[model samples]
Target: MSNCSGESNMSDVLKLAQKFNCFYLSGFRTSECKPFIVQGFQVGLIRPDVIKQLLSFPEVFHFNQDCVELNPAFRDYDTRSVKVDEVLKELKTKNVFMTLKGWRDECYEVKTQFDTPSLLKMDRSATCLFGIRNYGVTINGFVRHPEQGQCLWFQKRSASKQTWPGKWDSMVSGGLSVGHGIFETVYKEAMEEASVPDNLLKNLKSAGCVSFYFESERGLFPNTEFVFDLELPIDFIPVCSDAEVECFEILPITECLRKILSQDYKTTNAPVVLDFLVRHGVVTPENEPDYIKIIELLHVPLQTIYWHRNKIKENGFGANEIQGSQ
Candidate 1:
């Protein structure tokens, strides 16, 4: 309900953008987390508490003093996924932590980079436990209005949603779950979330991505949002097909920027919106002094941070290389 303490003193959009990226800013202490190594690659970062919890399952998680790795004996992807799922199900049943309670049946592919093969698949809710770098798609739906200049669409999330209930967000946004490519996710989320049809979606234009690291009570989130700009016809009105969205409203660019920086908007959604703003010339270096810094925050180096953490072994793997994933 209230903005960050003394946040009112922050006058520029760059300061507001920094609030969502504390994971790479003032928040993270590399000393407190262990690199979540899997298949000889540094894939995620696990906190000490989570490492301690995983240590209980020695058969599933092999370890050294520096990092915790998925047991090399699993041999292949299916075995690794099933084995890890077994442990997660046990943890969920045991109520190991609060993140397990909101478990969505959805699975997010865990990989060293977006192009790499999955090392394993984990329940979307539990990926944060390993500080996985998750990816999602965000569509910036906007229109060129005669009277209002340029207006962007915003959606009020359903009150029943698991996270960020009843908050204002981008028109069509959904996670990049396993088996879905970036372009495929755009088509799917556009129709499912906003009921925007194929003919309209044909105009979808890729505006690149926004990546950041954010942590909450749920856990660490190193997320990248593949952003797209969909220009809607003036007569087009978006209807929510999937019940994920409560309602949709069109706001002028100024109002959209205000809501994005306000307390009511979903913080995670702000980076993509800010990216849209900066890309469209709404926020500029002449107007916002920290333009370059915001650009850096929007693209955190999540993919490489893991391997570099605490000076991993120069021999290519962490301390020890697991023999399975090729």
Candidate 2:
């Protein structure tokens, strides 16, 4: 078999993560309870037995007939103020694989908006500490050549990267931590990854977001990425300023397509780059029959889960206002 461009299946790579409703790949299992409604959002799902374990942290979470939720009392508290160490420690002591060591230090918050009050806070490494959604960002850098046309810049990840080591990735990408805004993160990541100066960073255009519900060995990853398109000058070259990227390469748009189709790009980044190509008219229905499917795959129906939760809350159907309600 020839491992070449046309031989690879783009649909296989571009397909949205399989979803059981708003949740991903969760088959109908009686023991598995519906997802929890945290401040009117489907933050995560838990088994009935897991709900019992979470009850120990009464001030941190509330339980109802069908779901678990963040205790309303903590809405006004600092993201880190709601203490969850005891519950996490209990899960860890119980040998829950998701709560194991080396994943519990950097704090992460679950909030509807960046500046609004947080619904819950936990360690970044503990996403599966309890399955919840986290947001990130990916920035694409490209240059328009008079002769070669549009070309994209890709980074070869450092071998030491804890996740997806030694893979080709977008020009810049990073997790949107609790305290940072979208643009702030873009500037920081751009400077760190590709040495793009602030003056150049100012030209970045908001390219909306790409969302997916991914299941990994670590746990469920219901993620949304804010995408940015950066058009660099043709004469500009990217320099690696961080250890995350081993090196950088600028390739013609056609070669970029070949590399991505050949599975040379990281899994998450492939979709992001594909989105960029489609939006910029590089991939069109005339040339690629699957272009429409590729565009749809970049967005999943994650909002429906939260919308259902909101509607339920509007009908006066929710967890009891009292702390630790049965």
Candidate 3:
């Protein structure tokens, strides 16, 4: 009585299992079922009777085809019968919910209730009139010696770049893609901007980060940045991507701090760079007097900067507190 074609092969079933992380529940029903596919695997809703039959299968854990086991903790729930929004809310909080192959429609239905923006429209527009929500990864390359103290590596933004053309900034930084995790973004930006390999990434130490709201003429950008510190050999050559970086410089930590404090850095986003260093205790008040003045000019509250640092430590990453104007 199953609607599924008897012709459905083991390869197809395996693909489904890999995509949804679930075993085949039923293979007979096809006509009345609404099919969904994720990761190239097809899944379909089952009738109550078909659900019972699916449950009867020795390998099947749950009857819901749209719910898949991401981990041992996930239990199958009938997404067809369940309210999508409620399920998505639960999924967001839990972070462990895995969808069956072809369950994107259910996910979309849930996303709609949370006031999610149109990804289609946003993708089309190059100029973000409203601030585009973005989470970025930052890496701070440090060189140190037993006798000589620490130095920091910085990259000069490419002249062709739109925002901060030909200005010195963080060694590496970039926005995370939708659904990309912090570490993934960090690795990606490092590879793209600095040509750092994956093998070297594991050796980098995370020095923490600064969260800030930046409003500019172009649009508002909410940056949740993750900072990493890496101590490399003195002879290490940094390969800069011409598309993203124009050049690289290694400067003494004190000198770097001084430049940032003095506001002599030509980078358009220098304020953000300086704020990050000062907020993270990398540039202490005693070490840099001009930093205080720069902070004063921006009228940025000391408490807010401190809060940004603490929030990153507590949460591992910052979230956008300010919603973008639609």
Q: Candidate 1: TM-score?
A: 0.91
Residues 134-193, candidate 1, lDDT per residue (tens digit)? 999999999999999899999999999988999999999999898888899889888888
lDDT of each: 0.85, 0.68, 0.45
What global local distance difference test value does model 3 have? 0.45
Predicted candidate 2 versus true structure: per-residue lDDT over 141-247, tens digit per residue? 99989989988999999998766789999999988777877888888988898899888888999988887666555555667789999999998888878688899
Model 1, C-alpha of 272: deviation from truth (Å): 0.5
Clash pairs, model 2 backbone: none
Q: Which candidate's lDDT is highest?
A: 1
Give lDDT tens digits, candidate 3, residues 62-157: 334343211222222333223223333443354332222112231111111113432211220111222223345777776775666777788888
* lDDT score of residue 183 within candidate 1: 92
| Whole-structure CA lDDT of model 1 | 0.85
- Number of colliding residue pairs in model 3: 11
Error of 1 at 273 (Å): 0.5
Give the TM-score of each candidate.
Answer: 0.91, 0.76, 0.48
